[model samples]
Each structure stands twice: as structure tokens, then as C-alpha cells.
Target chain A: DPQLHEYMKLDKKYRSIGFLSARTGGAPHVMAADEAVKATNTEVVSIEMARDTKGGAGHGATIIFAAEDVSDARRAVEITLEAVEKNFGNVYSSDAGHIELHYTARASMALEKGFNALVGKSFGIIVGAPAAIGLVMADTAVKTANVDVVTYASPNNGTARSNEIIISITGDSGAVKQSLLAAQEVGLSVLSSMGEIPKSGSTPTLI
Target chain B: DPQLHEYMKLDKKYRSIGFLSARTGGAPHVMAADEAVKATNTEVVSIEMARDTKGGAGHGATIIFAAEDVSDARRAVEITLEAVEKNFGNVYSSDAGHIELHYTARASMALEKGFNALVGKSFGIIVGAPAAIGLVMADTAVKTANVDVVTYASPNNGTARSNEIIISITGDSGAVKQSLLAAQEVGLSVLSSMGEIPKSGSTPTLI
Candidate 1:
């Protein structure tokens, strides 16, 4: 797990979106998110002009927030996004346009670190369960060692068990299909190893 | 606009994710581009178990496709998510174990129509230019009659000196801020206008 500590060292943040409703004559302002707001650095707000006129009743606004810590910000973003969409049916279009910001603190740190990482690096891909030792080491290698790295994971990594982790990667159609197959392999292996499957379930799964 | 006629209808044949790839591989197999696939789609795909470990020489494969399409697919899932952040390095944890196939379609003629129309739709978005009545009617009102429609152009709509429409929706933090504000207020007004802006840009510009 300590190996994973290195991978986790990279600064990460979460984001959220929400819609705020004006109470009759009430002014338009973001609803208080309480501790969650403090935890995440929320920013960028948009009002759903469509919802603001339903029955010509009240005004609605959509807010986009970015937070400092990741898990908190991610939760905030989810809550905001869901709330706005549920309240405004027409809130789904990217046509409305979006604005994203990299705050000074985060931007400065990334610049300081990114350039150093870039200077001495060569291209390479990081494969395995994202939490695996190999991946963490590869991330570390890519960072401090000037190695360009790409990280990936399989369904076998118990990803199906938790919603806490999010993985992002790039691959071709063949690579994607293979990734799906690999995930299947990992999942089956886990099921059998855990004795959740009957001996009959062991039809000798295919590669 | 006739090019976009087919997409207006609900079609089932256009349901494969690996459509092109399947053809290229000479494999007739097609995976349903169901809700689950859409939910799981990402800009990056990683297949850790299928890694070709030749001592890190071509150890991994990275393929970059059109970022716009990738962004579009991702937006479908995230819906109204705001401030999306992808660090230079982060693992794309997978959930193949929990994969589910909730929707399916083998093939159909209707899908081909929809695909063609969808392509045309993009073209419409580009040249319609908000001032074109035919464009606005075709876009905001025609295809999406059930939804509220709104459109606007800057330079006070008539101050521009050029024949070619220059529509600018900036993505930079500052520009994004201004554009979003304009979208919200103008959108609300349009909904209230109730077809006040003529279906045709026949009102000659004073500019």
C-alpha cells in the first residue's frame, strides 16, 4: 500500500455543478453547500435560463465548483449536477458553454513540478491495476525520473466493488476490447478465488 | 437540412460501439452501445491484463482519436458536470467485473439515417450562426420542439462590419465566464420572447 502512497502524492481535485432557484423575489445566489463548499474550491456558476421561466415563476442558476481535495470536490460536483438536472430538464446541453480554471495554488505547483517531470522524460505506458505496485512505481518513475507514463486498470482490480475510485485512460478499439476482456478475466478470477462460484462454475474460463 | 432528416427519428440500427473497428478487424461482432457502454465510455481505454510485456518496448499502446467526439461522449455521461479536471497523470480504474448490458440492437436501417442526420446536425450548428432564422428554427425549435429555444449573437447583432459571421464562444477562464453569463441572460429572455426573434433573419441589420 505504501507503494500506492507515491501515486497518491500527485495533487488531485474534484468538481461539481448545481442549479440554484430564486425564491420569488429572492436574489440569485448559490445555495449554501456548508462544509462541502469549504472542502472543495468551487467556482464558475451558470444559470439555466430555461428553468428560470417555467410557468414564468422563478429564476434558476447552475453553478460549477472546483475544490481543493479530490474526494470532497467530486462529491460536491455530483450533488450539484444531479440537483440542477433534476430541477431543470434542459440543463444537459454542452451548447451552453463551460469555463474551467486552474487556480493559482494548483497551477503554480503543477508548473513547478510538470516542467521538471517533462524535461528528463521519455514516453512509456503504465499498465496494471492502478493501485498495483507497478502502477504507483511507474507514476513515481514518470514524475521524479522524467518518464512519461500512462496508467490503466482492469475490472479485476476490485473496481466493481467501490465507487470511490475513478480511472481514465486511452487506447484503440482493439485495446479497448482487450481491456474489456481483461476485466472479465480478472472478475472471474476473483469470483472463483473467493469461493463465490461453484466448482461447476469453473468451466475453465477462456483467455 | 434534409441531410439531418434521418436523425430526427428514433433508430435502433446505429447501436454498435466498435462499428468501424469491427469492420476493420474483419470481425462481424458488434458490441451494443448501450447505456452501460455510454456510462463507462472515457477518452482513455486501458487493458492491463492484455499488456504485451516486451521489456517495455512497445509495452503499451496509446491511440488518440478525435478529442471532440471523446468530449461529446463524456459529456453525455457526466451531463451537467462542471469543472472537469484530468491531471497529467491519473489511473483510470476500471469496473469490468460489474459490467452490465442493459440495451442492445444488432443493426437497422433507421440508425444509418440518424448517423447521417447527426453529422449534418454538426454542420448546421456551425453555419446556422444564430442569426439565421432557418438555422434557429431547424435547431432549437424543430429538432427539439419540446424544449425551450433561445439564440443570440454579439456585436449587438448588427454592428459587425463583415459578411461572414464570426461566432466566438471562448473556452479560456475569463472568456468562458463572459460567454456563460451572456448565454444565461439571453437564453432566459428568448424563452420569454416566445418567438419574438423572427423565424427568418429578415430584419435587415443597421450595421
Candidate 2:
């Protein structure tokens, strides 16, 4: 009975699980998820736009499917993917503006766990308005200097404004600093040139 | 002894709790929290920006404190409030653009819990990007029709992009439709006149 109980508990969690991370994340998966369920006898476990997309460097959403058999789980994932083939999300970084930076030479224990994995390491915080900016910043930081994006949050799961993206990149002190500067500089330059209004004032001035 | 154990468990939850919902919500409470802990013998329970600031129709944040005694908890809340008095958060709502709408006359049980309180009411959804639009839309809806703001979510705790705000208002079907149209019309007119760009494409081009 004890063994059966354990097995039953584990079984209830699901016998098989399949995952699909779309190219860019969004909530349209609900529509595609319906098609997935209708085509296969599987349950959609979770579906949401990811705080960070594009393999953790861009914007996108993810979905998980569970079933009693591996075939059913796999089929569900495949159907969802096919259903969304024509329309998927993408990180539109070029529209980003309102950049903010907070860099730490050495993270202390007082920092939130979002930065906990970065203790003792140097990290740079770059916030971009219009979440798409994270993709551009992440790409810029990693390419400009040897840094890894430790945290990527969009409005989907981050505390930023719905149009904002928060990126935390970590590396050696020198690299982090360099990466942050490059990312911030590039973001401001491009955004400003495009006439992005500053993040203050209520009405957009006709200027 | 059993009763004593129950009492101890309750004590761990805190003998007293004090709450302070700021006019707006954001993560800046971390700084105020530091000052509160330094000045009082209470624990800062939770602090964050609310999805809907200004009493569910505006933008803001909230903070909670707990302590072993009522006096300690109240003092912690006061200290935190006092520390943030000069720089409490506020919803910057005039900078909204990129709007989408989804309305439902009747809700099925499958709807997200955010709409549960509104399941039986005629609901109109208005989404504005940059998280500031919710304030304007919420204000307009209430003033234009006999409706109540049922759900308010921003990038802080919503599924929107960091710059988006989602507001759901409920009323009689006619009222819901009228309010939605009025709010939507006002938003589009003002935003468009301000040269608010559409939500497609990557870069903002000079018109």
C-alpha cells in the first residue's frame, strides 16, 4: 500500500511531460493550446509569456503539456507548435527607450535573490522600457564584453512597467562595467534618435 | 501543551500586523524598509508596487509590517511611511500608447481568476501600453458609465509588457459597452494626437 501510494502520487504529477518554448513569448498560446488538447489526449500544464525569451536572451512565451504517455505529450507539443507556426512572438527591441542603470561591483547578501546567484560577482542592471529593449541590451552586453545575463524579466513576471524589461548581467568587475556602459549607451543613443520621449510628464508633447 | 503549541505557531505568524498601501506601487519600498527595520523591532512583511495603483483605478504600491506587539508593528509602518513621505510612488499615466481590447458579456468558469469577481457582470477590457494608460481609462470608465473597476493590472504584477496596463470594468451590458467606447475613444484620440505610434513594427520611424 505504501509503495502504491507513492506511485500514485508520482503518477498524479503526470507520467510524461513535454515542453515547447516559442521563438518569442506571448499569451496567444491559449488559442494554440486548445488545438493541442483537441488533437491529443494531454493536459496543458502551464502556458505564459516568459519574462525573458529567445533562450533567455529575448522575449517569448513557453508552454508545457503532460499526459499519461510520452506519445500523447509529444503529440500535444507538436500540434501546439504547428498551430502557432504562422503567428509567433518576437522581441521588438528597436522600440525601446527609457533606460536606467544600477551597477554593483560586488553583490552583497542584502540583494534580492534575483541577484543572489551573482554574489561575489560584479553585475550590471540595465532597465529598458518596452521589454523589447532587454533583447537588444542582452545582445549588446554579451557581445561587448564577457558577461552572462543572469536575470531577464519582462512585465510578464518582472516588477517593471508593462513596457519595461529588466536585465541583470554578471561577469568580472571590469567586464561587467564595460558591458553595462556599452548596453546603456547603445540603448539611449538609438532610443533618443528615434524621438522616444523621456519617462516623465503625463502627456506626450507635440515637440 | 497542545494549546501552547498552537499559540506558538500563531505567534510565529506575528501577533500584530500593520499595512500601508501607498498612493502608488513599486519596488522602492526596499529603501524605506531598510529605514523601518533600523528604527523599529518589527519585520517588514511585504512591499511592492500594486498592479493597480490609486484604489484600483490608479497606479501605486503597498507595504506591510508585522511584529510581536501592536505598538512595534504600527511604529514600523509609521517609520516606513515617514521615510518615504518625501518620495512616495505615483502612477505616471499620461505616457500611454499601444492599446488592445477584449470584452466578454458573460464569463465561463475557464476565465482567469482575475475576472472571477466580474464573472456575472458585463465586462469590458481595455489595455494600454506603458502601464500609465490604466489610470486614464479607469477614470474615464467610471465617469462615463455606471461601472466598477474590477481588475487592474500593470507590469508590476500583470502579464502585460512592462509598459502595459490592463483594466477590466464591469456593469450592465449597455453600460459596459458605453463606458468602453467612451474610454477607448478618449484614449485613442488623445494618444493619437500626441503622435502615439502603433504597436506593430520594431523601430519607430520619423513620420
Candidate 3:
């Protein structure tokens, strides 16, 4: 019951979670996070290494925090940023290299639980094309294998490339491999049909 | 009480909300979404135009769906993808042009309510960085203005060029503009300090 109570607390806690993720250049993520927690009354939720193959951002660090309220959350984020800035030096922000801060309200439930459920499973990823095709590919992959859909991103949100759709799935290794192969078949078919085209128009030439 | 009840329904609905987003070529976003919805048993939550400034993805389309269950969601996604593939012949998928599929589980709270609460405000965005300085800049921006951070992205996540840190803040126009100016000052200082360095190791040479 205590564990159950604690698990239920995740929902309420997630609702108020204020998140600020910063990209740090060369700073050890653990060190940066430790400094942040030491400076503020916030909890570190996750720290992800930068391995953005699509944007070629290379090795960087991402840190997330859970705070008491919106204001407190912001304060935590601010503290973390300041700590990172003090520890490291060069820092920038842009559409590509970004710092995003927000409260997910209830969105934290998916982040907290969905991620736990999906981890340790093989992953199948398909990137590129409009959303329509991406959806089909994801659907096919799920149907082909006993995989769970983790997330599907559309460019409507400024976070993603407008001309791309990214879908990730997780399952057993065999299922994941099968899903990837199935999705690739669809992707290849789309690619082969496209042939080649000029760059100046709306029709994206298959890369 | 009714409003609270309705809001609670959103959490349940969000859990079941099967989302599918697609990036289209030259096709009109509205038309594509309409067609996808007409052909599927899902509800259209949002449709976004392709305005990817970073990747030069050009005018594209993104559509979201709320489905009955995971199976239904996948089916709807599949139908939409098929429709898009039928309409747009030259589709591609790569790091830059991607297709993503995922289920947020509890993360939908952020998508549903957090975004609504944050939207319609002026935005301040900063891109390019060394990460260390970026965090400081974001902290400064938030501290300087009565603004809330929408999102902070790290170059570690692939959407950004290496060595760049991007931050976005929102509030009143005046607050947003002030935040941008504050962050800019910090960025300029970092840029000035970095000057030029050898490319052999971690010290980045300004391009």
C-alpha cells in the first residue's frame, strides 16, 4: 500500500512538475545535475545524453527537474541553468539548440510510467516523410510485431523538422527487428517511387 | 465541479488519444487533414502547417488524432499514412525528414492543458551556444522578465547543431522581447569570449 500510495503520488507530483532542460557543452551531466539540486529545492527526474543523429548535435547533456509549483519549477530551472553556466562557459540557444521549460500538468504520467514500461525493449525507429505515411508505417510495425508505440512526433510542433515524422516503438528484440524491417519495406517503396526531383519545389526528393 | 469533471475526463481521454502527425510535401495541410479524418474513425485534434525554419523543410502538414484505443489509434494512423502516401508520391525518411510514432501515456496532460495555458503569448527564442552559457542565458531571461519558459532543448537531442543551446520563453510581448534581449547580451558575450580556437579537440572554432 505504501508503494501504491507512492506510485499514486507520481500522478499528482507529475502534474506540478516544472521542467527545464538545458544543453550543456562538455560538462559532466551528473556534476551539473548535482550542483542544480544542491542549489534548489527540486528533484532531478532524468538526464539524457545528446546523440541527435538527425540534427548532428553530437555529444551534449539534457537534464529534467521536478518542482513543487510553477514558480518553484521555474526557480529550479533557473538555478540549474545558472549552475551549468557557472560550471561551463560557451552557451547558445536557437531553434535547433533549444532550452524548453514547461509544466505538463498530467503529461508527466506518460513520461513517468510509459517510459518505465517501454524501457529495456528493443526500439524501432522510422524517420522522414509526411505524417500520413509515418502513421501507416508505425501502424504496420505495431501490427507486424507485438510492439508498443512509444511516441510519434509531427512537425506541427516547432520541436520537430516540418518535413519529417518520427515514430519509435519498443518490444522484444525479435519483434523490434521485425517491425523495423516491415517499416523499411514501406519506406523503401515510397523512396523508390519518388525517383529524383528538383530541390526548388514542395515535392521533397527522397534522400 | 462540472468543469473539473470535464477536465478529469481529459486525462482519461488523453490516455486513449492515439496521436498521428505527418509531414507533407507540397499538399495543402487543411485538405490533407480533412481527407485523413473523413477516411478514418478518429477525431482531429489539431492540424499544423509546415514551417520548419531550422531544417528548411518547407511548407508541410501535421495532423493529430484521438482514437478509441491503441489498436484503433494504430489503425487510424495507418489509414492516414496510406492516404498521404497515395497523395504525395515523393516521400522520404531520414534524420532530417523523419516519421515518428509514440504514445505518451501520461504525458498527454502537457499536450492538452499545458500547451493551452502557454499559448497566445509572445515568444523569445535563442539558438546557438556552448550549453554552459546557454543555461545561464535562459536563467537570466526568466529572471529578468515575468515570463514562463515554454521549452528548452539541448543540442544533445539531435535537432540542434552541436555546440548550440536553444531556449524559448513566452509571456506578454514586452516581456518576451525583453527576455530575448537579455539572452542576446549573454550570447554575444559568450561569442566574443570564445573567439577562435583550434579544431583538434573540445574547443570549438567559430565557423
Task: Quantify all predictions' global Cα lDDT against the true fold.
Answer: 0.23, 0.53, 0.43
The candidate with the higher DockQ, 1 or 3, is: 3
Clashes of each: 19, 26, 68
DockQ of 2: 0.01
The residue-by-residue lDDT of candidate 3 on B1-207, one tens digit each, is: 346436534434533454554443323233333444555566656544433324322234555566666665566566655555443321212222211111111222122221222333344444433344555566667777786665554443423323334455557777766766666566555545554421211121121
How far in Å is the alpha carbon of A46 misplaced in model 1?
A: 4.4
Give lDDT tens digits, candidate 1, residues A1-207: 111112112223322222222211111122222222433555332211111111112222223333444565567555544433222221111211111101111111111221111211221222221233223333333333322223333333312211111122223333433433343334334334443331221122123
**What value does the lDDT take at residue B205 in candidate 1?**
14
lDDT of 2 by residue, A71-127 (tens): 998887777677554323211233223455556566533223333434566756665
TM-score of chain B of 1: 0.21
Prediction 1 global C-alpha lDDT:
0.23
> Which candidate number has the best lDDT?
2
By DockQ thresholds, what CAPRI class is model 2? incorrect
TM-score of 1: 0.18
In terms of DockQ, the best-performing candidate is 3
